[model samples]
Target: MAGGRIADQVGRVLGGRYRLVAPIGTGGSAHVYVADDTTLRRRVAVKVLQPALALDQAFLKRFRAESQAAAALNHPNIMRVFDWGEDAEGPFLVMEFLEGGSLRDMLDSGRRLTVSQAVLVGLEAARALDYAHRRGLVHRDIKPANICFDDEGRSAIADFGLARALAEAAWTEPDGVLLGTARYAAPEAAQGRNVDGKADVYALGWVLLEAVTGDAPPVADTTVATLMARANQPIVAPFGV
Candidate 1:
C-alpha cells in the first residue's frame, strides 16, 4: 500500500514538463512511469526513487552521483538519461522510453539467441560498457535484465553508470544488500572489494555465457552462498563458445 501510494503519481507533473501517465515498471528503489513530456510533446520514462531512499542523505548523494554519471554519457547502446528532479514525493529521473522489453524477458519465454545472434547483441552492449569505462564509469550491474531493446530490435545497456549509486542506496535496506544480482555478479563485487570497469566486463561475460547456453546461472538461496560461488568458483565457458 505504501509503495502504491507513492507510485500513484499517475497524473502528477514533474519539472513542470513531464506528466506521469502510468506505472511502467518498478525496482527495489525506484518506480518507473511512462510519462508525457509536455514541453516536447513526446513520451519519456520517469524513474522516481522510492520515498525512503530519496530521503536518506547518504543514498541521495550516491543517487545524484549516479544520475550525473549516466547523464554524461552518449552511446547508441546505452540507455539515455534526459533529466532529473525532486519533488515532495522524492527524487526522479527522466530517460528515453524504450518499446521492446528486456533481454531477460525474451530468455524467460524460451527465446535464447544463437551464438552468432547473441554476438550482435553482445557487441552493442560491449560498446556501451567500453564507452563508460573510457569515461571512468562502471556499470557494476550487467545482466540480461539490464539489457533492453528498442522497437527496432536494437540492444542497449540500461542503468549504464548508476549501479554503484543504486547499489549503495539498496545497502540501507533493513538487511544489508549486495551491489548487484548474485547470478551475474563479478568476483570482486561479490567480495565487497573495490571494483572497476573489469567488474562490468566480468558480469557481461557471464551474461553472454547464459545467452548462448540457454542456462540460467545458479542463484543461491542466500546472498552469502552466491557471493562464495562467484568469488571461489571459476565460471565454465558457455557451450559452443
Candidate 2:
C-alpha cells in the first residue's frame, strides 16, 4: 500500500510545526507521514502513534522516555530522531527522511539482494547495533521493516526503542497479538527470557539470510507456534553462503 493516504491527516499540521504532506507508510503500531519541518525548512518523516496507544498514559510515558534516549543516539547506520512530542492529535516523532525505502519494501517487491549487497547491509546494521548496545541500549525490534536506506543506498536501523517501550505499556490487546514480528524474533525473546545484544544479532542474522535467500526463517501458523518452532532450533544456512 503506497502511502496508505489519509485525507484528513494529509493537510493537517502537528505541533504547529510539521505540515503533513503525504502518508508514506503504515505499520501495525502507527502510520508514517512525510511532512515538512517548517522550522527546519526541510522534509522529515513523522510517525504518529495509534490513537489507542496514545490513550494509554503509561505507554505514553514509557514511549516518551524511550524516544528521548533514542534521540540521543548518533551513528551513521542509525536513523536520526530529531524531536518528539504530543499534540492534539497524539504522540509523534520527527525523523530524518530516508528516500531509498526499506529492506522490507525491497523484499516485498520480489527482489533479493546479492551476497555482496547483503553483507554490506548486514555490516552497517551490526555496527549500529553494537554502538547502541555498548551504551546500554538494546533494540528489541530488529526486522526488515525497521532497516531503512538512504538516498545513497546506505542502510540504517530505525525505531530504536519502540518495542521495549511498548512492552512496558499497559495497553490491552488481543491474546494473540505479539509486540514484535515473530519470524524475526530471537530465541530468548520468543521464550520470554531476558534479552541482551545477542537478540539483536540473532534477528539481524535472520534478516541477512532472508536478504540473500528471499525467504523468512520458517514459521508456523499461529504467533505462539511460530515462536516455539524456532525457539531452540538452530538456523541452517543454505548451500553456498
Candidate 2 lDDT, 1-241, residue by residue in tens: 1243364688888988999998888776678999999998999999987667778888888888889999999999999999998866668899989999999899999998999999899999999999999999999889899999999999999999888877876664343445338888888888999999999999999899989898777767777887887787776776666
| TM-score of each prediction | 0.89, 0.92
* TM-score for candidate 2: 0.92
Model 2, runs deviating above 4 Å: 1-5, 172-180, 232-235, 239-241
The count of backbone overlaps in candidate 2 is 0
lDDT score, candidate 1: 0.79
| Candidate 2 local lDDT, residue 94 | 92
Candidate 2 has an lDDT of 0.85
Worst 10 residues of 1 by lDDT: 171-180
Residue 37's lDDT within candidate 1 is 96
Among the numbered candidates, top TM-score falls to 2
